[model samples]
Target: MPRTAAPPRTADLQARPYKPGDKVVAVVDLPGVPEGTTGRIAVADGLTWRRYWVRFDNGEMLGHVDQHALVRARDWDAFRHARELERAEAERAAETSAEADTDAGGATAVAAGGATVNGVAVPAHLLARSKAARERLGA
Candidate 1:
């Protein structure tokens, strides 16, 4: 007698953009996570509303994440830009602190209320104003 081959898996009727082996990022926290995280698409299901099986960097596998809750991982250029802006803000805050110390005859002067960036205190109103300006400028 001849050996028989296994049957092929069933194909989904619905169409979707993503497929297995695609990289993805979580726009919102996955189940049991404290916050949102990124993952790889281990399985893609076009038939269901909950469409992806995501494998996170930490070795955890999420069985079902909706397509809307995830985006292509390559689309994080804006996030990278925001991180660069945050680093620049921290550096500026440190420089301002040093200048204030020098002007105050080496005495430490604590800001009453402000936004702290990278452990440096920046004036809250200034930070807020700058943020508004950036938003207006579409940066």
Candidate 2:
């Protein structure tokens, strides 16, 4: 049997993160507009059904344009920079969490001449007082 290609997954599709005032180029022709027309995103409003209103250079203003039909004019450079920043932030967060775990683990160890109570050191005198008080209260 001949093998068939799998349908594209949602993650395989590039996300359209369009915003107002973004310069874009249409990938498909629309009413009164041709492909490769330069435009500015006038407004972006939608929740589940995302769309954009674009004012093309050819004096055509199209509304309810599907985000997939347009691409940012500088998507390559802009997306690369954004991804690099996200990666750097993630690395910094991981390092910070690792440092915090190490610090907490070290803190739980009993220090010299002191007993730990809830991971914090209590002086010998304080421990003795607490023992006596506990005995008096029968607790």
Candidate 3:
């Protein structure tokens, strides 16, 4: 059998000392963590005195988070990319309403649809359907 020597450790592979300007990953650990219940990991821009002031992937400015709950991010670049994708997906979903409206020549119209309004097919125009929807027997 042949023996191979172990590779030298690299600075990049080591956990960096916590720094105010350094990027970190926020982790939430429970008192009694159980299997399958994972803590949250988020990218933090920087740290404050005893906490971190960073923006979450959801764009909420989490002004302060416990320093003990944060760790040096394993891959900052990948984290940033994932966060961006998450934000973009959220924005897209928010802008694109699941409800459909009949837009005809820049104007909305009322029409029958698979959706039910007062047990009847909903109109294509969301607004019109809503207004007429109030006329339901028990609505």
The prediction achieving the highest lDDT against the true structure is: 2
lDDT to native, each model: 0.64, 0.74, 0.46
For lDDT, candidate 2 versus 3, the one ahead is 2
Better structure of 1 and 2 per lDDT:
2
Query: Which lDDT tens digits does candidate 1 get at residues 1-139?
Result: 9999642211211123578887776665766542346678898776656588888876678876777766667654444454456678789999998887565532322344554554455666777799999999999
Each candidate's number of clashing pairs is 0, 0, 2
Top TM-score: which candidate number?
A: 2
As a whole number from 0 to 100, the lDDT of residue 70 in candidate 1 is 67
Clash count, predicted structure 2: 0
lDDT for each residue of candidate 2 in 1-139, tens digit (9 for 90 to 100): 9999754332223375688999987766899988778899999989887799999999999999997777777663454455466678789999998777556644644454456554455666777798999999999
lDDT of 1 at 88: 86
Looking at candidate 3, the ten consecutive residues that score lowest on lDDT are: 30-39
- What TM-score fits each model? 0.40, 0.44, 0.27
* Model 2 residue pairs with clashes: none
